[model samples]
Target: MEFLEAFFGVIGDLTWGWALIPFLVVIGVFFTVVSGFVQLQYFGRMFRVLSSKNQSGDPNAISARAALLLSVGGRVGGGNIAGVAVAISLGGPGAIFWMWAIALVGMATSLIECSLAQLFKRSEGDGTYRGGPARSIIHGLGADYRWLAIIYSVCLIASFAFGFNAFQGNTVAGAAEESLGISRIWTGILLTGVTGLIVFGGIQRIAKVADVIVPIMAVGYIAMSLVVIALNITEVPGLIYSIVTNAFGFEEVVGGGMGAALAQGLRRGLFSNEAGLGSAPNVAATADVRHPISQGITQSFSVFIDTMIICTCTAFIILLSDVYQPGAEGVDGIVLTQQSLASHLGGWTSYFLTGAILLFAFSSIIYNYYLGENALTFMTSSPLALQGLRIAVMALVFIGATAPSATSVFFFSDPMMGILAVVNLLALMMLFPTAKRILNDFRAQIKAGVDRPVLNPDQFPDLDLDRTAWTGKIRENG
Candidate 1:
């Protein structure tokens, strides 16, 4: 375990220090500029597109709405809660400023990647669709990039399935133990059982459960946070000021400095919203949409919803209260969040937080499972391989639950995420032209005064696409 920690720590430092961080900021900025600031222009349009029906009318495939819910289920989990706490503890209030910055840029990044996913998506004739950075490489860039595709598939499975999923399990188990005196192993078993049930049911079923539960739990948690915010409304202005100034302030430099602030903020923001990180695009590809860019725009809204709203809510809950401190030794992660909220609203909120973590983590585990399963489909279509993946996911959930702490799980997972991001971001860079073309197509159709923009695969003769997926404008009221 010590060796594993050392290995991951070394790799994490190298990746964040030299590569992923710069790449993230650069590509995010590039896409945001290249897209003509699409994430902002169609802000209202994203919701309209989200609320609209699946015009493709493919019953077997997932809807744009379900895809949003599923992706949100994955994005708005322990990371938003526990992960935000860690960022504040390590980097202070300033980290929140950086988080907001990355998320804003990442909104454009998510739009491009997810739109590319939809544009290059292939149908299986069973209403199931497969696309991601990997599929984009295969069909969009041709077979020569299969090696990069394989690396992406492996990294996606490693990061989301085994690594991040384990952390979620560890968090849920810890929360259960902290709040209810439940044995971690018992919690592990329970998570495994529930995870197996939903993951084995497949993605659409995952959507069925997520649509109902994720919104309620998320809203409840956010509403509770709003109560805390309201209670401390007077302190809110000073807190926001601190967040911005400390982002590059001198005292902060003397303390932990801007580097730690930027690192943790970008890392956690990516984990929370998953915009440019390439995770959400897999879910986006499954949606049945009249225009691929509509799903892209809709998914972009999710990044804002996750980081700008939900994560900010968690940040405010800690910063507005008396609980958080800069560079606090050994007071980080989920415990800090629980303690802060407990202080604000009393002890019973611990139980409430525990319940919320279960909902968030459970939904995330299934979402993670679907992503890994999608990666498997990219590598192979064998049922036995997928079943093996299911069992492996269940086993990891148990193991992660029984683990001693979340830090170990994070150390192992964070580096894996860095690798995956590099691969996916490279694909995004290479496929930038394709994404831009798709975005232009959507913009042109909307300019033509069409109420709902639709893709004509015939128009994109230079690009390879599955024409069967886009027949015409979305069906009436669909």
Candidate 2:
């Protein structure tokens, strides 16, 4: 067991090493440029489409708003709060700056990836929407890449069932154990019950719950952050200055340092928003929006909210409290943030963080489960096989909650995430022309005030547009 742990630890460091941070930043910036800054052009349209019903004659899937909620629910959980705290602990206040930069660049990454997922999305019985890296891989890379799709599915499921879900559950359990004196066992069992109840109900049910919970939790958390920030308003200027100066390793930064600040910022920022990771796109693929760009734009905003708003809020709360020190001993993860909050807010913080952990951790499981389930659809056709997969996922959730260290689990997950991002990025790059064409076409129609917009995929036959783009369009032959 020790040997295996050491091995995975090395692998995790190898996969998540400093080098990958620059590479990810480059990729994000590159896509943003190629997309003609679609993040800005379609920003307003995204919110408009998300709010208004799709009147474009498409079969009803879940509304775009629900899709946005579900995507936020998936990405914005424990990572936003605890993860931000972890970043600050390791990377320092400057990490917040890196996170903001990544989110800005990641807006493009989010747009392109979600747009590709939108294009390849498949409709099963009852107008259900299903598409992700699997479909995009198969469609863009051809049937030959189906094997890669299977590999991706397996890795994704493994990461979720074993790595993501377990780590999330562990956070919840550990938080409860420390804060409320609730036994970790009870917390784990309770979490498993809550997760199982929602996950078993499938995506539609998950979407409904996210639609309600995500906004409420997000607003409440953000509101709390605002109050804290207001109380420490005097520290705001110095904090912001330190974050920006250290972010670029500027000479003006304290302690005569640049490299450490830059490294910490990039690493924490990437970990926080997970923009180039291709995880949230899976959820974005499920929304019933009019155009692919609509979902893409909404996803871009989601990235902003996750990192810029929520994660940054966590950063402020910690910095304002002044309880965090760069080399602080015996502090990490949720505990570090908990200490900062408690220093100013008192013992009640323990309960607040525990509740936040529950919300963030459980939501992560739902999103993780959905990603795995989608992956499994490509792995096998047998109903029995699928049922077994579900059971295995639940079992892993239990095991994961009690696992010794989430570090080992992340070693496996981080690599898979990198590979998945690369595969998905390749497809999105190839599909760029189609995405741009769709965007231009949609804009034209919207500007013309066409009550019923019809997007003919045949207009761009060279792209071999996938069925997901067709939505509810009925072919003449059919």
Candidate 3:
């Protein structure tokens, strides 16, 4: 076990620490430029698309709003609270600035990947749509490269379904144990039970729960941050200055300088928003929106909310309170955030944060499960296989809660996620022309006075899309 852990740790460090981070930033910038700054051009259209109603009466298909919340559930989680604190502690306050930069370019990456997912989406017999990096690879790239899709599916299942859930469970259990004096075993059991309940019911149940929980948790957390910032209004300008300066090697307080800031910020930012990781595309493809690009636009909004809004809230709470100690041992992850909040609000804020972390982590756990299930479906349709996977996931959640450390789990999972991201990014690059074409078509309709741009598949004769799924045309509403 030790040897395997160390081996995976080396792979993770090499993949993420050295290779993936730079590649992610470069691709993100490339997509941002090639997409004609879609994130900036269509920022308002994102919200408008979120408010648009479903174009089809497909019962299994989720509305665009529900899909947005589902993706938000997956995006906003432990990474927002614990992960942001980790970035700041390791990389200094400047890391937060890089996080913002990555997210800005990542918004364009998200738009491209999600639009491709929708473009290549396959319709199931049950009236649901299914698509993602795996599906897109198979359909868009051709059957000869189906093996690549299979590899992606397997890696996604391992990273999200099994590995990520364990990490989330560990964080939640550790937080509860520290704050409430609860036993890790009991916390694990409860988490396992609740996760099993939601995941067993599948995507619809997951979507329903996300819709209710995401808004409340996001608003409540942001509201708390607003209060904290208001209280420390005098320090706001200096704090912002430090974040910007340190990001560029100007701040002496940063330990490893700008390099550390860039690495940690990009790592945690990708973990939080998952913009180009291809995970959210699974949920984005499920939405029954009028135009594929509409869901893509909505997903871009999700990245903004995850990193820009929720992650910034965590950054402010820690930086404003003066509780963060850079280069200090044992002050990195969730502990830093909890202690900082307690310093400002009260001792009782620890318990409040534990509850918030519970919601945040559990939402992510189920969302991860859905991503894995989608991957499983791509690999094999065996009911027994899925059932076994569910049981295995629940068991891991229990084990993770009781486990002393999440180091090995994360070490293994991080590299797997790196692999998933690379594969998805490569596929997106290959399918760039198709995505750009769809974007142009959608824009043309908007220019023609169409309030809600409807997709007409007849315009794209070269594409092999499921025509029935895009048959319903939504006209402009006067």
Q: What are the models' TM-scores?
A: 0.94, 0.90, 0.94
Model 1, position 223: C-alpha lDDT score: 96
Which predicted model would earn the best TM-score? 3
Q: Which pairs of residues collide in model 2?
A: none
| Candidate 2 weakest lDDT stretch, 10 residues | 469-478
- Candidate 1 local lDDT, 11-100, one digit each (tens): 888776577777788888988887788888988887774554543465666777788888888999988988899899888888899999
- Model 3 lDDT tens row, 1-478: 7998888778777767688778888999998998789999989877764444443465566777778888898898888988898889889999999999999999999988988888888888676788899999988889988998998898899899989888888888988888789999999989999888988997778888998998888888999889899989999999999999999998757579999898888888987898888899999998777788988888999999999999999999999986788866566577788889988888888777888898888888888998999999999989999999999889888888999575355567877888888888888888888899999998898899977788888998788888877775663310
State model 3's lDDT. 0.85
Residue-pair clashes, model 1: 0
Residue pairs with backbone atoms closer than 3 Å in model 1 (clashes)? none
Q: Rate the local accuracy (lDDT) of all candidates.
A: 0.84, 0.72, 0.85
Over 4 Å off, model 1: 1-10, 49-58, 250-254, 257-259, 403-412, 476-478
Q: Which stretches of candidate 2 lie over 4 Å from their true place?
A: 1-14, 49-60, 250-256, 402-411, 446-454, 463-478
Ranking by lDDT: 3, 1, 2
Model 2, CA-based lDDT: 0.72
- lDDT per residue (tens digit) for residues 387-408 in model 2: 7766766766666666636435
TM-score of 2: 0.90
C-alpha RMSD (angstroms) for model 2: 3.6
TM accuracy, model 3? 0.94
